[model samples]
Target: MASTRTTRLDRKQVIDTALRLLNEVGLEGLTLRAIAAELNVKAPALYWHFKDKQALLDEMATEMMRRMGWPSEDQSADWREVITAAMQGLRAHLLRYRDGARVYSGTHFTDTSYAGPMETFLARLTTQGFTPAAAVRGWHTAYSYTIGYLIEEQAMTGRTFDLTARAERLADHPLAAQAGEEMFGDYDAGFDRGLRAVVEGIGATLRAPGAPGKGRGEARA
Candidate 1:
């Protein structure tokens, strides 16, 4: 991998180098030592900015979110559009690098960059009258689904599911054989449909009888 710039290294520069190298070496190959070598500094230099490799990864994930450009108040359209667009952006960002989903899975960012976008997402829902608890659940639903789905998507990138081949061996099973179309459908469409379902379910909850029911039929209608 290419070594970093000769200028004084900072947190952002280090992470930029790490992500560049990530595209080349992948998640498994990303390490503090490797990053230091790229920056042409001793490994200990990284500790000044990041406590450890996980901390660095958190920043990397944060930077990726920043670049996705979180929604603004004016950017708000319908609630469903808000939720689906956020989910889709996250999924696309995670797919930008190899194993990015796995890399971002457990990392937490303690900085403003992550906070701003997250706040933007939750605020969009709250302004529509979603209760705090409901807003959180909606965020979790979409975020968790994006992360989990992308993890599998990244894993299955070069491999084939080929349920058809397995079905041939079990030819007696009619259901398995009949599922060929279902098994090999458009992945992007399937993911969008799943995200839409989650958003729709959250909307349903708001619309249930005796609920605050804000942004339900009103915005959707």
Candidate 2:
């Protein structure tokens, strides 16, 4: 039988090893045996805590969430400021590990334990005068946009193509050329702009007259 401290240390070791593997080899290359090998433990020992690879991945995702500092309770800060901080934290966390966004996007965790950040988002939206349904939609829209943007950003990590040259080529198409220039000059600024746009657009829609009910119906129309 293992001592309590030994068991605790083993669990941390497994999770730490898994995170390293995630950064080094990505989600696809991560496995129970691989993690065990990395930690010099038997594969069955890892299974003692995590039932399977999916379980391990879920644990890893949970670990990632904790690292992101998702708000546990309402902050005294402004709604937009709090929500934006959470989103930016997620973006930074995803960028920390190779293909972190891809790993996160592929998994689904619907239980309350898995939705801390989203719960915070919904609460913020509601406090800002959005109805429940509107708040939910706003949360989804923000989450989708953030995840999609991060995935694209991660995918572009190793490209050798010249974005400026591409922009010059697209000069024949005026709008495309302008977009290319925007893309080439400070990509991080572009992401921040898009994030603000989505959040502000949701706020505007929620505030519009008869929007709580009417806007949702019209949006579906």
lDDT of 1: 0.77
lDDT per residue for candidate 1 within 1-221, as digits (tens), equals 75654566778889899989998888889999998988788888889899988888889887776777555654346667788887888888778888889888887765676766677777777766677778888788788988988887787777777776767876998887766545455678878877888888888775234443245456443
What is the Å distance of residue 124 in model 1 from its true position?
2.9
Candidate No. with top lDDT: 1
**CA displacement after TM-score superposition, residue 24 of candidate 1 (Å):** 1.7
Clashes of 2: 0
Candidate 2 lDDT at 92 equals: 85
- Write model 2 residue lDDT over 1-221, tens digit each, in one string: 53322343356678788898888887778888888767766677787788888777766777777677665575334555555676777888888988888777766542357565666677766665677898787777777888898888888777766767887888788788777657656658988898888877876775445533323224321
Clashes by residue pair, model 2 = none
Worst 10 residues of 1 by lDDT: 207-216
> What is the lDDT for 115 in model 2?
65
What stretches of model 1 exceed 4 Å from their correct place? 1-7, 170-172, 176-185, 206-221
Error of 1 at 15 (Å): 0.4
Q: Estimate TM-scores for all models.
A: 0.81, 0.76
